[model samples]
Target: MKTEIRFTHQSLVENSKSGDRTAQYQLYELYVDAMYNVSMRFLGVKEDAEDIVQESFVDAFRNLDKFKYESSFGAWLKRIVINKSINHLKVKRLPLAAMDDNEYHLTNEDEHEYQNIDAMDIMKVKSGIEKLPYGYKQIINLYLLEGFDHNEISDVLGITTSTSKSQYHRAKKKLVEIINTL
Candidate 1:
């Protein structure tokens, strides 16, 4: 028998907006683990990720009326989780290169060169992505992991579309360097 996929949070979110505390708590419980994983991907540190997760959920609950249900509840919560993660990182103030108009190029040709690599190789690439500098890692995670296009990333990161593209190029370049070193 196929196990049932529960949608407790999605249901609770609808009810929570109507001011149901129990439903709100259920929603919190249902999404907490997944949100924590999202935060972990960005923050990398356990305590910080947990803190962000808590804050995101609290914010989501408090602002429940703002949820229009355009996206899935998970997607909405994930956005909140990501925003909290970004804020957490901002508090750390990691050094980043200033935005420059000059672009760094990463071609489809380069990506294709690694397409035939094994799973271990793919994991290595992800590891390299994790090791990238703060700005590069954030851009890469938003673009690659979160599936945001350059236009959307520009809005989210408060940069130009060209800047988003440039950052991604630099991030990819740094990834390639890391992969080559391994």
Candidate 2:
């Protein structure tokens, strides 16, 4: 017989913790489609994205009790999806550049350069990012766009923290070069 599903946040958590099969399925169904979109943002391949989404849901479910509602369920699920995508890429052994302790700084005057930049200018910069090589693109996306710190990036990409820092520098340089060409 078909069962009814209640979607309240509290109900889902309580039922999920109690091993209610129907509620578990309901939880998965509620988030899978949205999580798949999140997965696809990192993993462009259709099947790979789907696989990441499924793995994320499984992982999320396994740790559901640990979810303290510090963030919404959707946010929690999105993290899992993103983590899965990073792990999937890591398995392919993408040649990650190592970072050094040297801090590369841009000139202060140029630092405020985007002050007058409008939406189109930002879009132009984003378009340039798309042209970067895979390694550069991912580094920029994670370190700059996603605001991940070097240590976090190093762990995610399975590279040294110094490597993460160096790759970020290279990615920024390449991005600026691309934007200048446009």
List per-prediction Cα lDDT, in the order shown. Answer: 0.80, 0.75
Clashes of each: 0, 3
**What TM-score would every model get versus the actual structure?**
0.84, 0.72
Candidate 1 lDDT at 78 equals 96
lDDT by residue (tens digit), candidate 2, 53-146: 8888788888889998898887788877877887787687655444455655446565465444344387887788777776787777777656
- Which parts of model 2 are misplaced by more than 4 Å? 1-4, 113-118, 121-127, 143-155, 158-166, 179-182
**Candidate 1 runs further than 4 Å off:** 1-10, 106-120
Q: Name the 10 consecutive residues with the lowest summed lDDT in model 2.
A: 111-120
Report how far off residue 75 is in candidate 2 (Å): 2.6
Pull out the clashing pairs in model 2: 98-163, 99-162, 99-163
* Candidate 1 TM-score, true structure as reference: 0.84
Pairs that collide in candidate 1 are none
lDDT of 1 by residue, 42-151 (tens): 88899999899888888887888888879988898999898778877877886345767674556788777555444437788778978898889888889888898999
